[model samples]
Target: MQATDNVTLDNCADEPIHIPGSIQPHGALLAFDIDGALQAWSDNAPQLLDLTLALGAPLASLPLPAEVHAIAAECRDLIEDGEAPAIALEVAIGTHQFDCIVHAYAARIIIEFELREVPSDAVAAFALKAHAAIDRFKRQKSIDSLLQLATEQVRAITGFDRVMAYRFHQDDSGDVTAESLRDELEPYLGRRYPASDIPAQARRLYIINTLRLIADINYRPSPLVGRAGAAPLDLSHSVLRSVSPVHIEYLQNMGVGASMSVSIVVNGRLWGLLACHHMTALQVPYSIRMAADVMAQVIASIVQSIEARERALMAEQSAAVRTRVMETLLHHDEPARALLQHAPALCLSLQAEALVVAQYGKLMVHGDIDLALAERMVASLPQSGDEIIERSALGDWPEELRDALAPWAGMLALRFDPSTSGWLLALRREQINTIRWAGRPDKIVRVGPLGPRLTPRGSFDEWRETVRGRAVPWDATARLAAGQLLGEMHRASVARHVETDRARSQLLAMLGHDLRGPLHSINMAATVLQHGGAAGTMSTRIQASSGRMERLISQVLDMSRLNGGLSLGLEKNLVDLVPALQDLLDESRIASPGLRIVADLPPALPLMMDSDRMMQVVSNLVSNARHHGAQGEAIEVTLAERGDTVVLEVRNVAPPIGAEMVANLYSPLKHTSVGNVHNRGGLGLGLYIAQQIVHQHGGEIAYRYEEPQVVFAVSLPRN
Candidate 1:
C-alpha cells in the first residue's frame, strides 16, 4: 500500500514515475535470467498464466510455446540494433490465447501477457484499415488537416471517447492543435497543458516506448516479486509498467477511466502525442494498438518531408528581394540607399515591424521604429560575432537601452561580422497576447494533512491576462531566412569591394594617359618661350597649356577626396545670386567658344547659401553643358524663389538619355569621349560632384529628359 500523506508539493518533482514498483492487474509480467528460468513474476501471474512451479522454475515446466523463446531472442537483439527492445506477438498456450510482449533491459528479460486474441478475419481487416489511414494522410494538403485526420483515424480504429493531436512548444508545454471526440465528450481542442504534467524522466521513457496504453484506470496495481535474494525487476521496457499514482488521480479527476498515447516523432525527436481517452474502462486489443503505432510513424515521416518543401518555397521568395538589393549595390556606390529600395521585402517577410541595417558604421532604418532606440540597440550589440541575438522582451534589456526601446519589445539582430560593427536588427512591437490554459496552473496545489500536496486543479476556468513588453517569438522559419540573408549579404559585400577595386584601377589607368598630353605640351611650349623664340605666341601657348594642366590636377584631387568619403565643408550667408551668375557665365563663355550660355534670374533674388560651394556646383554643370550638351543649343540657368525655398534649374536641349542608362550616368569615372580635343575622355565627375554639393546643402538635384531637352533641377531651402 502507498501513503498519500507522504506526497508534498515540494517533493512531487522527485516522484519516481519511471519505476512505479508494480504493474497493472489487466496484464501479467515476468522477469527471467539468460538461462530462460523465471526469476521474478507479478503477483497475478500465477493465476493469469496458471503456472505449476515455484520461483526460478524453467519455463519448460509450464505450457509455454517454442515460438515464444525464439521471438524473445529476436526482441532482445533490438537493443543492440539501436531499436526499442519490445515486440508484440500473439501466442496460444494450453487452450488459452494471449497477446505477448517481450522486452530486454540490462541483465533481465521482461515479458508481458495480456488476455487477447485476433480472429483470422480480423487480421486481414486490421491491415486494410491501417493502409486506408495512410492514404488519408497522403491526401492532406496542410499539417493542420493532416493531424486532424490522424486523430480522427485513431479514434475510428480504437473506439476511444476522445482523441487529440497535441503539439509541443519550445517551452516543453503542449497545446491541443487538433482533436476528434464522441458526441457525449467535451472538447479539449486548443487547450494548453503545463510541462510539469510530464516530468523529464517520464519523457525519456516515452522515447523508448513510443506508445503507451492504460486498459483499466481503476485496476489494482500488481507487484512484481523476485526470488528471496534476487534484485527487484527493472520494468523500464515492460509494457505493463504501472503508471504514476498522481496521474491516475488526474485522469480520475477528469472523469477518464482509461487512456492511450502514441508518440509522434519527427527527425528523431519527439514532436507531439496522439492522445486518446475514454470515459469508461476500455480494453484495447494488442492488434489495435499496433495499427495506431504504425499510423504515428507514417505521420512522422510525412511531416518532415512537408516541412522541408515549405522552407524551400519561402527561401526562394526571400531571395528575390535580396537579389535585387545586391544588383543595385553592384552598379551603384551606396549600400544604405540600395537596401532601402527593398524595405518592404525585408520587413514583411521577416514578420518585423521595422529593420535597422548597419554596414561599415553607416545605418539605414526602415519601417516603424524610434530612430534613437534602434541606434542604441544596434550600438549595444557586440561587434565580434555573427551570432543572431534575440530579445523577446525589451524589459530584459540593459538599463541604458530599455527606455529607448520603449513601445517595441522584441528584436532579432544579425551581425555581418564579429570583428566589425555592422548589423541587421529586426524589431517587433508588444502584442496583447491571449493564451488558453487547461486550468490556473499556478493554483494546482492543495493543502494536505502533512503539507501542501500537488494535485490536478478542480476547475478549468477561463483565464485572461494582459501581456506587455514582449513581441511575438522569432520562429524557426524566420531565423532560417535570416541565416540565408546573412550568407547572401556577406557574398554581396565581398563582390562590392571587388567592383570598387576594379573601378579605382580603371580610373588610375585613365588619369595616367590623360595627364601625359598636358605635360608634353607644357614642356615644348616652355622650351620655345625660354629660348626667346617668338615670345608673345610661345608665352600664350605656355599659359594655356599650364591652365589646362591645373584644371586636370584639381579634378583628380576632388574625385579622390569624394571617393574617400571626405566632408565638403560649407559656409552659408544670404547673398545676391545675380552677380555670382554673371561671373560664372563669363568663365563658361571663355572656356567653351562653341556653345551658347544665358542666365535668367530675378534682379533681387537673394538666399542663404555657401557662395564658394554653389559656385563650384554651377561651374561643374556649366562645364558639363559645354562638353556634353548639343553644339548649337543654349544652356539655360534659371533661379526662382518661392516663399522660403528656391529652385535652380539647368536645362539644355539635347538627345534624351535612355531609361536603362540614367542610373549609371551618375557613376563617377563614367563618360563618353567628345568628338574634338578640348574635353576628350573627361572623367565623369562633373555631374557627380555637383550632386554631392547640392545634397550637402540640404537640397536635391534630379535629371529628366523632356522632348528635346534634359533638365537638372536643384531645390534648396532658402532660410
Candidate 2:
C-alpha cells in the first residue's frame, strides 16, 4: 500500500478524521497522506517513522490492519502496561502503515498513515524512533540548540544534498547563513540572493503559506480546482501533487531537479526560509516533508535570537565607548588635540581605519591617513557644515584620490558640531562578497580599474575579503566605533563649556568687589565739595575734577551690572519737581559759572519717581548741556506734565546732534559729542546710566535736535 492511496480511505468508526481549516485549534491533531511508491517497502517505512519521531507522537498505540494485528496487539499491551508508544502502527483495517500521536492530555490520538507497501520491521522501528525524537524536541530549550538539532534531524530524514538556513533581508533579499551538507558538498556560507529571484508577488504568497515541495523539476503541474491563470505552486493541501510546470522548468534551469522550502516565522512574520535541495530527480513523501517544515520553524527562532543578541551587545558597547571618550577629552587641559589623538585609537578599538573631524571648510583633525596626502585631501574637499557620506567618487575629492579608493566602499559621516565642525567622517570598507548591485552602477560600484568597482562581482569580493588590507575603504565596525567616540567628544565639550562659564562668572565677581569702594569715595568727595565749599577756588576745582572721576566710576559700575544681568531697583516717591530742578540748576551753576542757565519750572508739579536717581539723571543732563552746549550759551531746564507722566527737558544751544551721534546717543562707549567735551571727559556712562535708571522707573528718555538746539528729556511716571 502506497502513502498516496491512503488519502481516499473512508473508514470512520467513532468520528470522521477532522480535516482542520486554515486556523487549527490548540492541541489539534494534524493528518497528512504520504505519496510515491518505494523501491523497497522496508526502506520507505523508516522515513515515516522519522516523521512520527520529529512530531513527538508515539506510534505503537495506533489502530492497525489485520496483517499487522499481532504486532499491534503486542504494542497495545506494552502501552496498557505503561510502556511508551512505538513507531509501527495500523490504520484503516490493515491496508495502511500509520503513525499515531496522543494529545498532551492523552485523551485521543491523531493517526497519520500512508498506503504504501512497507516492511513490518521497518514500520516498527519508525514508531520507536518517532517517539524518541518527539520526546527530545519537547524537552529542547534555547532557540539555537532547537534549530541545530531540528535541522540535523530533518536532513537525516529527508536525505537532501544540502539543507540551508535562509534569512531574509529588510528588502526581501535572502542570504544563506547556515547549511548542512554531505562531506563532499561545497559550503555556501554567507551567499546572498537578490529579491528579484523570487519576485515580490511570490514572496507575498510565501508569507501566507508554510510548506512548498517540488518533487521533480521535470514533472507537469496539476492545477487546483477553480485556481485560474497559473497552477498553484504551493502543495500543503494537495498531498503528492505535482509542482507547477513553470517552477519546475525554473528549477531545472538552476540545475536542481527537486527542492523543498519551509517558512520560518518569528512573531507571526516570515523571517526566513529553510530550503532543501537535491541535484537529482527525487520524490519526498508528504509526511517527511511536513516534519522537516516543523524542524525549520525551530531553527528560525534561534536565528532571530542570535541576531537580536548581537545588535543589543553592539549598542551597549557603543554607549560605553562614547562615555569614555567624552570623559577623557573634556577633562583634558587641551581638549582639541587630545580628542584628535584619541580618535584614531577609538576607531582602531572599534575596528575602524580613519577618523575625520570637519567643520565648514576646516578639517579640525584627521587620523589614519598618509601625512603627505592628508593636506591635499583636506583642501580638495568642499567646506560644508553638513553630515554626509563620501563614497569613492560621491564626495568633493580629487579625482586621483577618488580613483585610489575602492568601489562599494565609503565613509559614514555624522554631524558632531551643530554650527561649525558639523561633520565627523568615519571611513569603512564593506567586505567584497557582501556588495550588491541594484542596476544603479553609478550609485554603487562593485569593481573598476580606478580602484575596486562596486559592480556585483566587486561588491561580492569586498564582502568575502575579510583581511584588513583587502577591505578597500576601511572596516564598518571601526566606523561605528568612531561614531561612539564622537558622542563622547560632544559630551566633553559640553562639560568644558560649563566649567569655563563658571570661571568667567567668578572673575567678574572679584573685579566688581575690588572697584566698588574707590568709586563710592570719589562720588562722596564730589558731593562734599559742592555742599561745603571749603577752599573757594581750590574746592571748586577739586569738586569739578572729582565729579568727572565719579562719572567714570559710575559708568564702569553700570556697565558691569548691565553685562552681569543685574536688575535695577526703583523706589518711587511723590516729590516737588520744581525743587529737584532748582537743586540741580544750583549745582550746575556752581560747577560751570562760565555757562548761562535758565530754568522754566511750574510752581506745583509733583512727580512720582525715585528722587535720588532722578536728581542724578537731572544733574547728568544739565552738566552735559553746560559742557557740550555752545560755551557760555544759556542751558534751559523745563519741567512739565502731559498725560500720566511728568517730563523734564534740558535744552542746549550746542552744535546740532549728528545723525550718527543721535543713533548711538545712549551708548556707553560710543558717545561721540559727550566724550569730546573736555569738562565731561569719561566713558560717557552718565547718559546711558540715566536712561537705564529712567527706564527702571517705567519712564522713557529721548533726545531731539532742532539745528541750533539739542534737547534731552526724561519722562517719569506720575504719582
Task: Give the number of the best model, judged by lDDT.
Answer: 1
Once fitted onto the true fold, the runs of candidate 2 whose alpha carbons sit more than 4 angstroms away are 1-152, 165-194, 226-246, 265-272, 279-281, 333-335, 341-345, 348-351, 359-367, 371-401, 404-408, 430-719
> What is the overall TM-score of model 1 with all chains considered together?
0.83
* C-alpha lDDT of residue 176 in model 1: 90
TM-score of each: 0.83, 0.44
The digit string of per-residue lDDT tens for model 1 on 332-401 reads 6556566667778888667788888776555678877767667788778875654788888866678777
How would you encode candidate 2's per-residue C-alpha lDDT over 183-284 as one tens digit per residue?
786566567665544544345445655776665666433221211232222322323334332345446645676788888877666677777888886555
Lowest-sum lDDT 10-residue window in model 2: 32-41
- Alpha-carbon shift of residue 339 in model 1 (angstroms): 1.9
Clashes of each: 3, 46
Model 2 TM-score on a 0 to 1 scale = 0.44
For each candidate in turn, give its C-alpha RMSD to the true structure in angstroms. 4.8, 22.8
